[model samples]
Each structure stands twice: as structure tokens, then as C-alpha cells.
Target: MSDRKPINDAMDHMNGIEGYPTNVDLKSLPKPLRYFGYFFISFFVLFFITFFVLSMIL
Candidate 1:
């Protein structure tokens, strides 16, 4: 007898856990949070670029 059903029907959230947010909605966030996200992403880009440029120069 098959007793197991689908773990998650939609499987949209993380690990198919209900009510677990998988992502941050940038459009829904307030202005400050949106800017912070942009800044956080830019920091990574600049950090890698700086290291690469320095390695090439040295």
C-alpha cells in the first residue's frame, strides 16, 4: 500500500518547507533595504576586481 504522498506540491520554498522564504523580494523591500542589497552586491564585485587588478600589477 502506497502511503507516502508528495513532500511539497509547489516546491517553491527552501527545502520544500512550507512558509520558508526562499528569496528576498527586492521590489517589495523598503528603499533602505533595496539600497543595502545593491551595496552588498557591489562590495563583492569591487572586492574581486581590486584583488585581480592588484595581482596583475604585482
Candidate 2:
């Protein structure tokens, strides 16, 4: 019994057409996760804007 990987492993790198194999597909997430991601991003942006405006006004 051999523990070594086959030579076909080298051909697997062709799957990444974007030139980067580590790219993350955020759109493929589930429904709840998409909502959570949108909420989190909007929350941070709104929070930053509110604080910035308050600081300028005060």
C-alpha cells in the first residue's frame, strides 16, 4: 500500500479561472447568511457615518 498522492493533483490547479485559487464566493452563501452579511456591513457603514457626522456637528 502506497501513501503518496497521484500525479493528477497538479491538474486541479486549472479550476481557478480568476488566477487566484483562494478566492471566496460570498454570493453562494445561504439565505440567512446573506441577510446577516448585508446587515453586518450596513451596520458598520451606518455606525461610522453617524459618529463622523456627530463629531463634525458637535
Which prediction has the highest lDDT against the true structure?
Answer: 1
Model 2 lDDT per residue over 28-58, tens place? 8899999998999999999999999999999
Residue pairs with colliding backbones in model 1 are none
Alpha-carbon deviation at 5 in model 2, angstroms: 16
State the local distance difference test value for candidate 2: 0.72
- Computed on alpha carbons, the lDDT of every model, listed in order, comes to 0.73, 0.72
RMSDs, each prediction? 7.7, 9.9
Off by over 4 Å in 2: 1-23
Q: Please give the TM-score that candidate 2 achieves against the real structure.
A: 0.58
- Residues 1-58 of candidate 1 have per-residue lDDT tens digits of 1233446755544334544444556599899988999999999999999999999999
The number of the candidate with the highest TM-score is 1
